[model samples]
Every structure is written in structure tokens, then in C-alpha cells.
Target chain A: MTFLDFAWPSFLAPGRLWLLAVPPLLLAAYIFLARRKSKQGMRYTNTGVLQAVVPPQSQWLRHVTVGLALVSLVALALAWARPFGTDKVPRERATIVIVLDVSYSMEAVDVAPSRLAAAKQAAVDFVNQLPASYNVALVSMSGSSSGRVPPVTDHNIIVRAIEALETQPSTDVGQALEQAMAELDQAPAGEDGDPPPGLVVMLSDAAGTTNPDKSPRQAAKEMGDRGVPIYALVFGTDNGYVDIDDVRYPVPPDFSFFSDLAALTGGQAYAADDASRLADACQKVGSEIGYVEVDKEVTATAAGLGLAFAFVAAVGAVMMGARWR
Target chain B: MAQPAFASPAAAVSSVVTEPSGATIPLSRLAPEAALRRLELTIVRRLEGFLQGDHLGLLPGPGSDSSDARVYNPGQDDVRRMDWAVTARTTIPHVRDTVADRELEVWALLDATPSMNWGTGGVTKRDLGIAAIATVGFLSQQMGDRFGGLIMRPAGLRRLPARSGRTALYGLLRSMLAEPIVPDGTKGPMDLPQGVAQMARSQRRRGLRVVVSDFLTPGDAELDPAHAPAWERSLRRLAVRNQVICVETVDRHEIDFPDVGEILIRDPESDFERYVNTSDEAARLRMNAASAAQRERIRIAIRRSGCGHIQLRTDRDWVQDIARFVLAYRRVAGRLHAPPRGVSR
Candidate 1:
């Protein structure tokens, strides 16, 4: 989901919103009393003589204490509402497997330099953005898919593996998914007898050789059942072309296959033709893989802030030597 | 107990008449008797010699109309007062002198109103009045004069009989110190005018009549043009019979308020309350102007009644103020008593 679409859960104590009216009412009463006090002068033996020596200060400054108190009261009312917000909490551990297409068709220069080069850069950017505690593995898929780097927490090793990739004769999408799942399965189980949350980021043009022994949909179903989501990034535009042996071959990008695979695995699919969209896809994927959402009650924090305001108001009153009416 | 050595009046006066330094010691800090004793010492040590032989005679005495002329001795006779006619006839120097017929009677009309109890300074206006009275009383004693007073208390008028000596004077001071201070908002039976009128009616002696008060009596011409002050007529009466010195006691707070933003002021005697916005510049200015005008009017009233005026403030060193006043009065007296210009006898 987009960042703007993020929503907080409903307040546990919505009825407390009605208490917000107390501060303004108190402020109004204070103002009325202050005005009345200003009108009712102090008792002095000689006002004429006293007026000649003493000058009055600004009226607003005298109300600083009451103003602060009012703010604190408003803060207290907000605290009473028992607000619960959606917080992005870090998972204890996580595993991310980056699958790169090393197929010959990935050499298309529809994007800057070539699609393969752009995909490698996006993979490196994505790994760099992930949390240090996340184990990142790399897989290169062409005629056959292989785990270039076993699942590890060192992002530098994963980045180096992506850079070392070379173009192969054919694409084997089903093999890449199988290799990524194998890398995820190798991660150590947590104390609760469950593996850490896993994510697969596949960067390719979605044009692969068909193999009856391995189906992409079957692989996606297996990963989904195991509670792993695969983020599929389809590179190159629909009008993409590749040059092979001095002859330019039309190899337009196809996203339907990757889109269906991501949908089955409870993940998203993105199509990128340029560096900007590639970076955006990598950033969204990185954030989604690294963090988990949880409901957090902020009542205590709001109460603490309210107390702090109250303390400030009390201190202001004491310092100003303001008398109670 | 060994008796304390008594210094000559002139020597004692010289020692204490120097400009007073520091603040006025509050009565609360000392016992009533001790405070009065300290006041007595201060007054005697500062004013004795300056006022010696300055008492104006009220009756005839041993005369010098050539009737009491005697042969003058060179060392004993006052050379300035040598009788020229007697010297010319007897072929020898002769002098004439006159002795005072009676001791000077000094009376004080003290206003011990509720207003006097208020002071923002080191001491209350009432304390200042007592100090003034002590100063005048001790000075009168040093000059071998009788002292008496009329106190205007919140309860009623208190008449102190004229008596001589330090004991009688201390007794009067002790009584004044013992006088009950009326709290704020208490309605007093008598105002300053009635007190002065009472003094005028009872005390018919020709003496130095001193009136010590804050002089804030309302219904005066200063506050309202149509009405004359209640004390004006009585003060005139006292002024005619006695050498009236209106010692107007003032406090700084009476002239100007401290910068306390808003205050409610209540008149102690009248129980009248007024809320004032001290923060208002215009209001402050107006209050100050009104006070100044009232002071000027009081001065005019004192002048019209043919009485000498001296204002003593609670904030000031009262002894120094009194010394300055006495010195100025002496200068004026010297000027008035000086022989006609170029007419040396």
C-alpha cells in the first residue's frame, strides 16, 4: 500500500474527546476572573503616591501561567482518548532472497546502459536499504538457477554476487523461484520453531524458457503456503528490443506472468523502464520486507506530555508569583 | 548606680546636631521606654545649644528702661549691651539686661488618626510623629520650658496636662507610645479639625504649638473648591494664640504607589475602599497630580493661618530633616532679629 494510505486503528476511548471542551471553559473562566481582578484594585493607604512610583506591566504576561495550564489540560484530554496508532516495528529477524535474471534477452538497452546492468544496480540499492539484521541471499537464473550467495546477513556479499552475474543462453523462471525458496529454507529457525519472515525480490523481463519439470505457478503456491511473499520487478518497456549477432530482435517486456506469480504469493508486481521507477520499486520492496505493522497504544506517552505541560504551568505560576483569585 | 555625667547643653547639642546618617530606627526594634530614651538623647544632643535663649517672652520681666542700670565690670558685662546714656552720665561704663519672666510653654497637637498607622517605609507616619514630638519635647526641656500635648486618638480626644522636667516629658512620650493603633476600616470619632479645635479651646497659653499629622483630612478646599477644610478655622485660632509649627508627617507611599499592578486601597479612618489600576499610566499621572495639588493646598492653608510648615517623610532620616528645618528657622530668625541695616546702636 502507498504511504499516504496508512491508517491508525480506532481510539479505545473515543468518549474522552468530549473532555476536550474543559480546557477552553476553564480558560474562559480564568480570563473573566483575571479581568475582574484587574478591575478590583488592591487596598493602599495612598494610591496617588503609589501610582507615581510604580508602573504596571503588560496584561498578557500575567496570563502565561493560566495559558500553559489550559494547554496542559487540552493535552490531558487528548491523552484520555486512548489513541492507538499503526507503528512499523522491526522484526526480530528476516530473510530476503534477490533473484536476478542472467538471460541473454536481459541485455536489451531500453533502460540506461542495459536492462541487466539496471537490474543489478536496483538489486544493490535494495540490499543497501534493508536492515542489517536481515539475511540477504542472491540467485542468478538463466538456463538453470543457482544460489550465488547462501543466505547471509552481510549485504556487501549479496551486492558482489549481483555484480558478478553474466548473461546465460536461456531464462528459467521456475528454477529461480525454486532456488530462492531453497535459500529461504536454509535460514535457521527461531526459538518458537518457526522460520523468520521471508521475502523474495525477483528482477527480470519475465521471458523464460518453458520446462515441464518446473511450473512458476506451482513454485509460487509452495512459497505462499510457507508464508513467504515474492516481489516481482519486471524491467524494460513493452517496445523493448535486443541486438543479437549484429541483428536487432524485438523482445518486448511481458508482465502478466510476473504479476500472476506475485498475486499468488501475496506480494506486489512493478514494471520499470527507467532508473527512477527501478529505484522507487526497490525502495518500496525494501521497506515492505524489513518492517512489520503492529498496533501501539500511545495513552501513556500522551499522559506524560500532559504532565510535563502541567509541571511547566505550575513552575511558571510560582516564578511569576501570580496570586489565586 | 553611678550617675551619668551631664554635658553642658551647648556641648551636648554640638555632638548630636551633625547630619543624621542611615535610616530611622523602627520603634518595633526597641522597647518603648528604650526608644523614648534614645529619642531623648538624640534630640538633646542635636538641638539643645541651637535653641538656647531663643524662647520668646510672653510677660514683662526685670526691665532695662534705664531703671535696672548698674555699673558695668569690664570682664563680666556684655560689651554689646553697654547703656550709652547711663555710661555718658556716670562717667563710667554701665549696662542693662532683662530676665525672662516665666518658662516657655511648648504644646503639641498630635493627630493619632488611623491613617498615621500606615507606612511602607522603615517606620509608620505615627512613629515619625512621635519622633517629631520627642525632638521638640527634648529641645523644649533643654531650654527650661514646660511641655504638654493634645492627642487625637480613634476613640476620643486625649489632653495631656502641661508639665516641666524630663520625667513629665518621658511620661507623655510613654503614653503616646502606648496609644492604641486603630486597624484599617475603623471609623474614628474625631477628625484633625475637631482635635485642633479642642486644643484651641482648652490650651490658652502662648507657646510653641506644634501639630504633627499626615494632614489628609477630607472635605478640604484642596479636594473641593466649595468646601473649606474642617481644620482651617481651628488651626487659625491656634495660630493666633501660639507660634504654630505644622509638622506635616508624610510617607513615600502617600506620594506615589509602588509598581504593584492593581490594588484596592481603603481609607483607614473613613472605611472607604477604591479599586485602582496602578498599571494605567494616565491614572497614575492623575493620582500624582491630584496628590501634588493637595499638598500645595495644605501648604497654602498653613501659610494663610500664619503657621510655620515642615514636612517630614518616613523614608528620610528624620533627625537630619529636623536639624535642617531648625537651622533654616534659625537663619530666618537671625535675619528677622538682625539690627536695621547700617543702624548700629
Candidate 2:
């Protein structure tokens, strides 16, 4: 389901295009007469009485069966159409870092069970779903953020670093992001003189940091300006119930600044509201902007769905027979 | 207290209406004697022009034309009879309108009896009657001949006078339904022949007359030519004059007695009643045979009556059966109406 192979080196299989006709034929049959009563069939006097004695006839169900049959037929046709693709989908040949915010303020149960927990869960999910071809670096932020794993193609290591993150008072998201970018800048570019698209996924509540000189938003904006699209996820309650710093600020800093910073570039910003949405957010960042390769490989050989179509046709015949009986 | 079962409380009081079975059958036209609703009028409209024939009263009376005299067609009848047109259109003999078919005026007849009320099928005998009468009436109207009707019920007959055209057809039909049910059986046994006789005399011209009924009436032993059977002489005499159409209406149970347990039966005639256990297969078979025999009598009566016959049952397809009959009749009439083909010169 990963559309990597088709991105650039898309090989067209002509045979698959021909399979499109079977469904339209079936649709025509569905729309037209199923039975020929006569050239000008006499209109029955009592349609109701005739209906009762006649077998069960479902117009819509037949239409649906015809539709499925056509779909399966097309599938088979495409199979014959000989769909072809590149051997391996192009992968981003570059090192990338993900800085995850794990702070006490992250515990502001604003977004969910707690901002820190949501951030950690998202970072871990993000690491797990990403293509393994790219080297990833992991950095954790608190009152002061630190790099746990430098950018490398070692998914297990990156995953371990993300998992090890825990809530703490150190809330410097800026430091964590800067450290990640520094790690990525040292990596060599691919043969084309262009580094595979570098993606920096930043997970945070954007609710901490006393270092006003370079705020988390400013740090993200600066990093994004230098070619990296900073994918920022802001986890918090818009109602301003989040905790900040060692002292309760009563009002969380409008974390909208971090999202705006990321978006200023052609980057993305996601809101962590649920586990599924958070996972999808990370996956989207990795695929669309990151252009990164995953560890597991996917190869699709479009199988002739003719048999599937035949199965549908059989079901339809059975239904028609039962009604006739 | 239960609205005396027989609508004719007068009859109920007059005689000990020995109900054959305890089942309380309403021995009356159960329909509310209200003004014809706008809907039923439409049912006729839909069925208009189905059956065509000019057999007024549908009985071969003393006045019915039984002569078939026609000239042979020339050049495949394409060039046959041309009187003044022979000298005008072209110097060729072309025959047209030479086929002689005695224009028959079909009188719409309906049987609206209490027994007609029971229906195991989609429609009651009354409903079939409605359709049958409308089919014939519309056909007659379409042919541009005189038409009228007789609507029969257990109560009595309502007579609508013979007239020509669509307005008369509609009026006769509406009036048939409009005739108030005098509730007390005051009008006497549904006069099956009143409408036919009325149309016969009123028109004063011999035409096709269609008599629609279930023919459930018991045969009068004397006048009936056979051992008294169902609808014998009454139908025969009606069919004696004019081109007669015998439309016999029957119901499912009348033909086949389905084992529906002990059903209380009531004879629509005589107000005579008794009990018969339907649970016994033997008894059911016996009753079924008798019904079949009665149907046979009905069939024979219609045949001997010298009339075009059609039978519609409550449990069977009345409309299709009707269409099929009409188509056959039309086929015959079409052959007769076809210009006579020429003999090779």
C-alpha cells in the first residue's frame, strides 16, 4: 500500500487498462432488460398479484453484484494488463533527526492522558511506522534537551531512544531540535549532490522553556529555513489548562507559534488528539515530506481478479436461481 | 346485537334462515351504500376498451343477424368495390367496407352477490364483475354502438337504459354503481336479466349483449332442460336471442376445497343452512366434486345457450384471462371484418 514504487519510476502495464471494460458491460446489462418477455410485453393487469407469485427479484442487489463483478473483472484485466513497477521505490538517502518533547509540563493532561505521554507515544509510533532506509537521530527535550541517538539507519536504536524518554522538568525543546539538525548537517549527500529530503519531526506540548532568546518556535523556524521541513506536533488543551515550567503559569503559552513556524516552510503540523491520528500524522510526515525509505519492503504483482469476478457472477446466478425457484 | 348477520333482517325475521354452518356470513351486499368514490371510477378508466364486440345482450334472440354474405376481394381485395369512387379516384375497381359484421351492442352485466363477496384470491367476484362489465362496456363504447348494463346483486338489479357513445357508457356504469342498495332485500333476488332485458327493449335494435354473473343460481328443474343444475335455463333463455356473452364468475373454494378446517358454509340461495366438517378429507373431496360438477353445469349451460363464454375466478388471474379472451374474440371478429380476398381472375 506504500505508493513509493510509483512515485518516479512508475512503469506502466498496458494490459491492466483493458480490464476496465468488463464492469461497464455488466453495468449495461444491469441497467437494461434482465429478461425478454416479448417484443412488446403485455402489461400485466394485476402487478401486485403477479409480484407475489413471482420469485424474489432484487434490482439493486443485482446491480451491486454486477458492480463487484466488473471490479473483479477489471482487477483480472489489470493483471493481464501486466502492471509493472520499479524494483525498489526511491528512498530518501539522508540522515534525519526527530526531537521529542518529554517534560513535566508535558504532563499537562490538556491533550490526553498527559502531554508528555502523548508526545512519547507519538514519537515511538512515528519511529515504528517510518521507512527504515533512512538514518534517524533521536533527541529528547525537557528543561534542557539532549541527543540520545545520532542520525543512523538503526531503527531499533532510534526506537529505543524514543521509548527511554520520560517526563522531567527540563523543557528546552529548542535545544533538542538544534542538536538534531546539527547531527543531520554532518551526514554526506547522495551521488546527485542533493541529500535525500531531510525530515525533522518535532513532538512537543510547546508549554515549556525559560530561555527566551531562542524560543522553541524560533528554533523550529530557523531549522525549517535551512532546508529541513520541521514537522511539529503541538499537544495541549486549547482551553489553556496545560502546566508550564516548574511554576504553574496558570495559562499555557499559545503553542500555536510552534505550528506556525513549521508551516511557514512547506512543512506540516499535527494536533495529537488520539492515538490513531497521532500515528497517521507521523507516517504522513515521514512519507510526504521525508521521502524516507522504510525497513520492510513491499512489492505488488496485480493478480488477475478474473476469478474474483467469476465468484461474484456465480453468487449472482445462485441468487437468480433461488428467486426463480 | 352483532348487526343481524343477514342484512335483510326482514328475511331473517321472515324465516329461520338455517345457516348451513355456524359461520355468520353476511347474506347481503356488504358494501356501504355510499356515493361512488373517485377512485373506483378510475379502475374502470384503466380497463376501458379491453374487450370488443357488438353482441348486444350477447344472446341470439329472435332479432340477431345470423347472415354472412360478402363479395370476393379483387387484386388481393386491394381493388374490389368502388362505386362513385371507381369513376373518380381511378378507373379501377377497388372494394372497401364490403364485409358485413352485424354491429353487436355488448351490455355490461355484473353479479354483486353476497357469495360474490368472498374472495380467496386478489379480488372478489364483485370486483371481477366490475372489471368484466367495464371491459365489455368500454369495448362496446369504442365500437361506436349502443350500450348499457345490468348490475346484479343478491339484493336486486339496477337498470341503466341503453344509449350510444362514451357518455352513455360512463353514465350506465356510474349509474349501475349509483343504484342504492335498498338494504331490506326490498328489490328482490338480484335481477340478473333486468339490465339485459332493459337494454334489449330500450335499444329496440338487436345487438350483442354480455351477461356477467357467477351463475350461482340453482337450475329450475322444469325449464332447465337437464336435471336441475347451476345457472342452467336462466342463462340459456338469456342466450336464446341476441349475441349472448356468458361471463361466469367463480371463486377458489367453489372449485377446489382447500382443507381449511371446519368452515361454516351458508347457501347464498334459499337462506337454507347446515353444517359440514371440512376437516374430513373424504367430506372435503365429496364437497369438492359436487362443486366441480356444479361448475360443469355452469359450463354446459353457457355452451347450450349459444353465447360467447368467459369464466373469471376470484383465485385466478381475471385480468389476463380477460385479455386473452378479448384477444381471441377480436381475432375472430378481425377475420370477419377483414375485406374479402379476390378469386384469381
Candidate 3:
């Protein structure tokens, strides 16, 4: 499998980021359009019987072609804007601890789909895309910093930790980073001379429910001085409002603290208000500070001819399978 | 079909030739003026005979008027081309050249590879190509030549046989009118040196051969002075048998390599393009120098080859240059084999 094409960081301006989800969203919208049209067609009589004989893929093929076209459009758009795999970074390998906020305030609807849900999904996406050799650890950080998964070679455990996360009622942005740094200090000695430089990816809304020692900004700066970068993703805007339990809580989603953290650590700060934007933010973090050489088995065998035979068999099976059905 | 009414058989030689019948008709007897009523009439008239029509390219072209915006000169100019609107607008007198209709047998080695078609100068080199064909046709008609061009059209390389130089021109004109046409089957632009060399080897007689080309092979190490010299040598050798003329066609942007901005220029003939910045004076200078140097060597080669040469620009008055070149060649021709004085001074 030839695994690559044009590569660059795939990012879009916040205003147009919605274009990223245009494909799947449009497909779902088209399905709704079809259902609406079918409903309208049914006013003449019972229409359920007609649906049986009409081939689904024909409709699905139309949908598939539309979806394929839209996907290719996005791929081209991404290609034109430049897209890349995070694993092939220029610098040496580094350690990244994804510190996600799971505090009770994360339950606030200041950000769409709730803050905890966004953070967990974003963190999982980040871990999954990391190269296999990338030393990644997960920290379910809120009232206190607890290393849910320590830096390890395996990726599934970290992804699992991210998926099982729930909203906790407190937060300590400082303690969380400190715990992540401690975990990095203990990673096994590498074959290189210098211990892999450490970095932290802190995804949160930046509202502190607990005043742990050294504010998130202060700790992030101190880490920067130690040659570590903290890329922060602040969830909402300053004018955002949250309604939960029949109480409306206005959020001055203070990302200034997180922005300061990034500036201090010589990293980056991002804003994400939607699921797609969160995915972009995770992608950004991976691109900025991720590089690990995992052994890639690229078998360039002339299987085109062989694959044709298998494809012929598989297609026959499917066709025969359809007859049986 | 009307036949020529001759006072005497000797006077009939001066009669105008008719298309519907190859018969000659006295001028005064023509229906009013010999103007075509409809395109269909002309097409039908042409089909009536052996597709034979009076040669139009033989008529001398109007002198060159290659200007972006031509000014109005009333009695001092061609009053037929007065731009009344411009006169009304600027109050400054201006007159447009009454565009004349003429045809030219245009033979273009249109470079159709991806590069010639891809240019930063809005108009690709290929655009310049067809435009040059049209421009030559437009300009050539000032003298009254019909335009027929040879392009590597959609079908493939179809060489519209060189017939009445004027008839050849009409063929080209028809092709241009068929513009924006995607040639059905085209295995495009040939290699200049190799192609010209082959043509030179096979050509049987002395006739005018005007080559509209940029003469640069794509992706080669910056042009080796030796190659152009060699092409000129072969061309000159060909001149021994034919009246050879090379229209050195080029784009203005190609000449100066103007400091516009950064660009990626792809050579249509060879699918190789490069990111270039014209802002750097040195780079621009080098581009200009290389092009200038190659052309200079070409001039040298052509002069050495014993054939006439002229440069046609997509941006310059190509007709005037062509006219001037033709006039100059006539003068040189008049002098070279001028009957030697008995004293042989």
C-alpha cells in the first residue's frame, strides 16, 4: 500500500472549519431529503411495498457517488490547503502527556456537546493518531492531577482511558501538568544522548474550579523554562453562556491564561467550539510536537493482478449472496 | 453561371475570376460590387467549382499598425477607421484602424504539451501561439490575404497542404475561426531541431517557409548556444532549396522576466515547470540575457545560413516587422543578384 501523497498541516480558518464536516453532514442531510421526498410520494398510496424491490445501492450508489464526490472534494480541499501525517515530523522524538479537563464545570454547555465530551473525544483522536513509538501518557485532570495511563509503547490503554472519562467536580491545572512531567522524567532511557524533550497538550476550557499551587499559566511557563511546551486548546469564547440544571452560567471563557501558557512554552493555543474543530485542534497538537519512527511494513508487491483474481471471487460471492438473499 | 464578355480575347486576361465557374468576367459586368451576399452563398459558390477561388494571400498586406491604442488621424490617416466613440469621449481625436479582411497560410508548430499552455502571463504561450496566428492573419489581411492556419488540431497533426500562398492563408483563417476547438486527435508539437532537420532533408523545391515557433526544447540544460547554431545551420542548408523565414515569436513577459512577483511557469512542450521570482533583478537579467543571447546566436546562425530572418512578438507589431523584413529582403534581393555593371565595381 502506497501510504502517502501531498503532505502539509491540514487546517482551516475557524469560520470555514465547518466545511470539514460538509461530506458526512451532507450525506445525512441528503438521507433526510430522500425520506422527505419519499414521504411526499406516499400521499398517493401505501409506499412501503415499493421500497422492497427497488435496489438500495442504486439509491445508495447515488448517495455513495455524492458522498464519494464530496469526500474527494474535501480531500482535494485538504490537499490544496495542504494535509500531512503527524508521524513524519522534522525534529527528534518527544514525550506528550494529554491533560484533559474533566471537572464538573465541564458539564456546562458553554461549549457545544458539553466540555467533558469534547475533551475526551479530542484526546482519544490525538492518542490514536500518534505514532506507535510515540511515548504518550494520559492524565484525567480536574480537581487533582492523576496519571490515568502512564507513558507506554501500547496505545489502546491510553485511548480506553480517554473514552471512559467522566466529569469530575474539581480541577488543578498546575498539579495535572506537574504529574505529567513526573511521568516523563521516569520513561525508559532512550538510545539517544539527550532524554527526549517533554511537552504537554492541555485541553480544557481554562476555568479553574480549584486553586492548586502555581496557576496553570505559571506552571506552563515553568515547564517552558525546562524546555517543555504546553499546547492549550480553550473551548469557548469570552462571550459564551452555559445553561445547566436550569441555571444559566455566563462564561468569560478565559483563554488568556492558556494563551499565555502557550506563549511561555513557545507552543500554540487554539479555540474549538465544535466536534470538528476539536478534531482539528488534536491534529494541530500532533503536527506541532510529534515524531516517532514506528517500523512500517510497506509491502510493494505487484498484487494488482493477484488482487484482480481475489476481487473477481469476492464480487462473485457477493453477487451469489444477493441471489440467495 | 455568367461568362466573361470580352471585347477581344486579349482584353479577357484582365477580367476578374469567378468562383462558381472558373470563367473570367469583365469587372464592369460584375453584379454591382463583387461582394459576397451571405456566407452560404460564398460556400456554395466555392463548391460549384473545384473548391477553387482566386488567391487572396497574394495581395500585399496593409502596412503594420502594431499599437495597443492607436490614435486618430483624419486626412493624415485612414479615415475609414475613425473611432467616433473615442472622439466623442476624450474629445481628443482618435480613429480605430478599419480592420481589413485578409487570409494568410499560417503554419504553426503549436507547442501543446502541458507547459506551453501553463503560463503566469494570463495568456499561455499556446495562447500567444493561436493569437500570433490570428494576429498574422489580421495583419496580413491589411494587404488582403485570406487566413488558413496549420495547428496540431484535435484530430492530430493535419498539415493543410501549402497551396496558393493565399489559399493556404485562407485555410489558416478558417482554422482560427474554428478556435476554442479541441483538436480531436493531436499528438502535438514536434521537436524543432529534429523536425526541421527532417523537413530540410526531404523538402523538394524552393518556396517560402515561414516557421512560427519559440524554438526552445523544454527541460534541456539552459539552451546550449551550439544547438541554435546547429538549427540555423540546417535551416540555412534548407534555404539552399527554399525561401526560409523564421518568425521568432515570444511573449513580453518572457523577454523582461519582469519583476511582477513569484510564479510557476510550465513549458507546454515539456511538462516541466519551476517556481520563479521575477523580482530579483539578477534572475530577471539572467532570463533576459539567456533569451537575448539565444536569439542573438540565432540571428548569427540565420545570417550564416543564407536565409532571411524576422522576429514576431505576441506583444509587438508583427505585421510591420514582417512587412519591413519582406521589404528589406526585396531590397537585398535586388542588390545581391542585381545585373552586375560591366565594370563589376
Candidate 4:
């Protein structure tokens, strides 16, 4: 997401948002009073003497303090409206399938220490952050896809399997999803005979050639139908390249394809062009897939901010009041 | 001439600073009677010799009242003054003579304009002026000398008739202190020059004349030392006949600019107002230069007019300043009060 992007919140008590009108009115009144107090309306025995004596100093600090105070009031008014923002909460139980690309292009050196090694480390970190009760599996994708570790409550086995992965010949992302879906099918049901929620996190360098029988899109759609969402993390810059048969071939991740795949599976897409970004992307994907969305009240935070701003304004006034007089 | 004597510091009491509009302030608050009992204001100009009271005048004269018998000249003396009793006892012609008494009539013209109402140093300029008047009055008033006052406002001038004794002097001071403050922007035909000219035209006989004011003309922005003040000519004319002492009253802040950030400075007697940024050192220097120039111009004008000038500051001790001025004045009074070139003393 770009720096300016924000998730706008919905309010429970929308009618109370009208209280936001108070700050502007107060600002107008302050301006009027400041103008009236500018020495023209006040009486001095001799203005001629004062003209020779007093020089004007910048009152910008005073204005800044007042502005802060006004912002605090706005925050308080927003809290009064009982606004709600989307937040992630830890899931009680879930099954996650990690699909790692072991294609020859994953050996590109654009992401430091090679793309595969960085992706393997990020996947291990991602798995370790999940709840202990969740079942995690690992799948390797190349010319043909196959499961490395079956779905299990203990995530250490999958982390070790990811560390042992090596680059293979061709890349087939559709086959990787099929393999990931087969691993999720093996997840055990709860004592009440209900299957736990399932999520698929895939880290790939690029979208590869697909078979006519199972396209990547068709596989993602089928996974969506089965209540499983795919979170795709792309890890390669456009300048990424690898040498095969003494000839270099560029291997940039197809970000748009992965985004479309994630959309089709009712999930989100993330892109990272470097090792640090790949680590951050892994953490983001882990948090997004491992938690459920819920509404939360943030009134206390707003009120606390309002109180802090008010205290600053009061302290500033006390310190600068002598000069004003 | 004997030097003016000052009372001991222990004998003098501190004066209270009161607002000009405060009518309840006693006369003694400005200048105590005991502090001035020993002090005297020397009158340098030769006054008209007359036996109006027991006080000695600058010049002794012959009077119509009878006195000691003396030998009379045949053509220069009055023949009706022959004393037969003294002639019969000494077998010679004698005449009866009379003693003449000189009474010093002091008229103090107090400027009570709006500018005098300002003071950042506890006492207002108006009250300081009144205090000056009281000091001068107490020093000059004796058994027969009369003390009087003229209050000059923007609209007109009010006069308090000259009267003798200490009680009359107190009454005059009380009247001056009780004068209503002239609100700012009050317009009239009268000003400092006009008021001085009026005092000169009306009080023809003068012994000592004191002009107490801030001497800040409402719209006179001229600061050149060569250019005399608007009232300088009138003061010179008045000095032509009487000894004029110009007591210029000022506040401390008027001369020393304080470093208050930005403030709107305005004139009370005029509509001139401007915003000033005092934080700039250069701006403050410019303002201080202008104020010093203005005060220097006043000093030069007063000197050119040949008047005895003394400046009283609201921040300083007025009594001590007046005392020091009086002591120094004794030496220069003869030179300052010299008659015009065409006239003889």
C-alpha cells in the first residue's frame, strides 16, 4: 500500500459526529478576541512613547499550541461518535499450507543470498508466529509439484523441510496450489466433526507455465469454493535474473497475476523486491492470514490524546503568559 | 547673595505617589511643609519696590509711610517731610523717611494636558508637575510673598489668584492636584504657547514665574535643535520681564525604551498610532535616538530662551532633584537672569 492509503472507519453513533463542529467555532472566536486584544482597542497613556519602545515578536508558537488544542478536541469529538476500525485478532484454530517456489528462476541473486534462501528463512519465521494449535504444511513447486510436509500441529518439521528446499527445473504455480489444496484436505476435524478454518500462504518468484487441465485461476477459484483463501507473497524485482546453460534469463515476479489469483481465492496479495521487504511481507501475510477481523472501540485512546494535548496547551500558556501580558 | 539652604535628610519625609485623578490626596503628600521650611527660592530679577508686607524685596525703596527722621536735601527731598521735633532738639532741619518692603509674586503655570496623565513609574506626570509646583511654592513662600497658579488644559486656562502665607500655598496646591484629568483627543484652541502668552499678557507684574509641564506638543514633530519649540518664543518674552524657570516633567520609560516584543504605540493628544517591533535591536536604537533628539531639542530651545531649566523624572526623587537644582541655581542665577541688552537692572 502507498503511504497515503488508510482504512477509513465506520462509526456506531454517527449522529454525534456533529460535535466536530465545535473546534472551528472556537477558532473563529479566538481570532476575533486576538484581533480585539491587539493593542488598538486597549488604552495606553501614550502610544507615541510605546511606538519608540516595543517591537513585535512572532507569536507562531502560541498559534501552534492552539492548533494542537483544537486537534485534540476534534479527536475527542470523534471518540464521542464511537468509531470502529478493522483490526486483526488471533485465531483459535486454523490450518495453513505454505507453497514455496523451487523453480530455477528462484535462484536469482536480485534478493540478497538468492531468492530461495531468503524465502525459506521468511517462511520459517512466518510458521513460528502462528498459534501452537494450528496445523501447518509445506509444498514445493517446480516442473511438477509435491508435498514436503503434511499438515501437523507441530510447525518445527515444516520449518526444517523449508530450509532443506533446492531449486528445480521449470515453474508450475497451478500445480503448487493443487498440492497445497491436497495438504489442507488431510487436516484433522475437531471433536464436534467440523473442519478447522484453512489458509494457504504462497511465496513465489513468478507465475509459470500451466497445464491445460488446471489453470492457476481455476485452482484458486476451486480453493475459494472450499472456504480456503490464498495469500500470495511475490519475492523478486524486475532486474532479477539467473544463468541457465551459460545464458542469463530475466525472472521478474508477475505481480498482477498473483494479485488476480489472490482475489479469486478471497485473499490479499503482497510484493517484496528485496530480502528486508520479503521478511516484512512474510510477517504481514502471517498476521493477515492467522487472525480474524473484528470491530474494536478506540474511545479511550482518543480521550487520552485529548487530555495530553490539553495539558500541553495549559503548560504552554502558563509559561508564555508573562510575555503576552 | 547667600546660598540656598537645604533641610537635613533626616528632617524630610517621603512623599506618597498618588494618581492625578485622586481628589482625596492631601497637599502634604506631594511636598511636606517641614521639609521645605528651611529651603528658599532666590529671586534674581529686580521687582517693583513697594511696602506691601514685611518681606524684603530685591531693591529698597522710598515709601509714603512715615519712619525715622533724617537730614533732608534742599532740592532732592520732599519739603513736607520736615520734622519740627527733631529740629527743635538738634537746632537743624530734618525729614521723616519711610521703609519699603518687596513682595515676591510667584505665578506657576501648570500644563495639565492629556500627555501629562501617563506614568509607568508609580506617579503620573501630572502629579509630578504638581509636586514640583508645591516644592517651588514652599521654597519661595514667606511671610508676605504671594503664591499663585494657572492650570492649562486643552480647552482653556484656569487661574488661582495669588495669596500670601503658607495656608494659601497649600490651598493652591490642593486645587492643582484636584484638577480633572483632560481625556485624550480633547480638542480646543488653547495650547502650551497660547497658555504661556496668556500668562504673560495677564500677569504684567512678575517676580518669579514657574512653567511646569511635559513640554510635548501634540502634533509638533520637529526635532531639530535649531528650531525653537512652539512655546519657546512665549517663554522668551515672559523671561524678558520675569525670571522663568521651566520645570520639564517626564517619565522614565519615555527616555529608556523597554524590550517588550511588539506593541501598538499611539499618541493621546493626537490620532497618530503605529505598531512597533521592539525585538529588533536596530529599531529600538532608532526609537531611542529619536527620543533623545526630541529631548535635546527641548533643552536647546529652553537654553536659547534664557530660562532656568530643570528636568524632573517620575522615577527619581523629585525633592532631591529640586534641592540640588536650587543649590546650583544660586551661582548661575545672576548670569541667567541678566536683563536684556537694551535694559538695565
* Candidate structures ordered by lDDT, highest first: 4, 1, 2, 3
Candidate rank order under TM-score = 4, 1, 2, 3
Per-residue alpha-carbon lDDT of candidate 2 for residues B23-78, written as tens digits (9 for 90 to 100): 11231232222211211210110011223333322222222333232343555543
Candidate 2, DockQ score (0 to 1): 0.00
Error of 3 at A96 (Å): 39
lDDT of each: 0.70, 0.54, 0.52, 0.79
Per-residue alpha-carbon lDDT of candidate 1 for residues A10-43, written as tens digits (9 for 90 to 100): 6889987999888888988887875562233334
Instruction: Give stretches of model 2 more than 4 Å off.
Output: A1-67, A74-96, A100-134, A138-149, A152-178, A188-197, A207-229, A236-248, A251-255, A264-307, A321-325, B1-202, B205-345
Where does candidate 4 chain B have its weakest 10-residue lDDT segment? B9-18
Top TM-score hit: 4
For each candidate, report its DockQ versus the true two-chain complex: 0.10, 0.00, 0.01, 0.10
For residues A195-217, write the lDDT of model 4, one tens digit per residue.
Answer: 78899999997888445246889
DockQ of 1: 0.10
Which candidate comes out best when scored by lDDT?
A: 4
Interface RMSD (C-alpha) of each candidate?
Answer: 10.9, 19.0, 31.3, 6.6
Runs in model 3 deviating more than 4 A are A1-325, B1-156, B165-168, B176-189, B201-203, B222-230, B334-345
lDDT string for model 2 (A1-325, tens) is 5776445322255534655776687678756654432222211111121122222223565566767667767666666655544344455465667877776666666556666666677777777776677778887777667778877787888777776777666466667767777777765677888766677777776645566445666777777687787777765655545445445654363457666867765577777555566667777776765443343211234453467666877798677445231
Steric clash pairs (candidate 4): A47-B265, A47-B266, A48-B266, A54-B278, A55-B261, A55-B262, A55-B277, A55-B278, A56-B262, A56-B277
- TM-score of every prediction relative to native: 0.42, 0.41, 0.32, 0.59
Question: Judged by DockQ, which candidate is best?
Answer: 4
Using TM-score as the yardstick, the better of models 1 and 2 is 1
